[model samples]
Target: MASESSPSDPAAWLALLDWRRQISALYARVRELRDSDPPAAHALWQAERNRLFRAHSQSPLLPEARADFVSLPCWPYDPALAFSAPVEFLPLERLDIPSSTGQAMPLVRFGRVELPVGTLDVYWIDVYGGGVFLPFRDAGSGHESYGGGRYLLDTAKSADLGSAPGGALVLDFNFAFHPSCFYDPRWSCPLAPPRNVLDVAVRAGERAS
Candidate 1:
């Protein structure tokens, strides 16, 4: 953990800034590949993600876990889980929700997507440089996957899966992944709210090992 004085230290601040830049670049590359070839893109994403978990300075895994870390267990890419749902724009309604960090972040309900399995509300974070946030929980929770939920798209942190024609957003459940908090308790992440919870078992994403 960084000390209290680390934030004020020039070297530490620069290092953190560099880390953010690297992560942004990594996500950008993933988006580019996803637009071209989704399967290949996902494969690359998994590989790069594993690399980050093993070698990145800001890996979420504890030191002891990192030594034995290989790759995150994920279900095979399933095309059935992919969808290009139309976005139903919602009224400008904002809600303040508590985060794992114990801070309440304001989020605006921007749209709703109706998938074959169910419907999910989309939210836009009400903050500077805000972006789309989509978290979902399924029956697999507490067993195969994280008990809290998995994030599908959090564009603010650059986990975009791409979009379809007519402004429909592409949501590929096979790309769903666990938040950092899943690996490290010290990290705090938002879980799937009531509206985002799905009764169906979405067995095509990252799972607990």
Candidate 2:
């Protein structure tokens, strides 16, 4: 049976709400820039990026943006490495996951799932002109989110980002991971496609406490 949780808990409930708020803010900022202005979108993206790397959502009073960028957690990534090539590269063409909703790239068995998995190539972060980053999740929904078992897609290593070469974008579910919410709820994360949902426990990455 299911039991109720407290809204005042220093951990569980409060953490959940805090996570929602961070995601909400990230989503809100992104929403405002959809068609507003590319430049504005870029700026907001940078700010959101700052929040993701730096400060987290205040768990107590639903905190507000503190110091210009001081209160924020400094991004661990180096701007110079944003365009660096991945250590290694591989090609994928199929993703094996659930996708009754959007487009699904087929793939062979991923993670512990004896079955195949599918990947949705919607949000691709262009790390460099030759490589792109695609974050995703799989069967392990709540068990392991922060790690969510994600992987990167690179063009320098694989075929071109386009359909010119023999590179496929099929993602590996074994790498599914959790979002910033796992470490700190002061961050927003994208939702995993329904097709990506798994019915079993994914014992990788950070677990909810």
**Could you tell me every candidate's TM-score relative to the true structure?**
0.89, 0.29
Q: Which candidate comes out best when scored by lDDT?
A: 1
Clash counts for the predictions, in order: 0, 36
> How much is the lDDT of residue 32 in candidate 2?
54
lDDT of 2 by residue, 118-146 (tens): 32343332223323334445554444343
Runs in model 1 lying further than 4 Å from the true structure: 1-12
Where model 2 places Cα greater than 4 Å from the true spot, the runs are 1-115, 118-139, 144-165, 200-209
Looking at candidate 2, what is the lDDT of residue 51?
Answer: 60
The TM-score of predicted model 2 comes to 0.29
Residue pairs in candidate 1 whose N, alpha carbon or C atoms collide under 3 angstroms: none
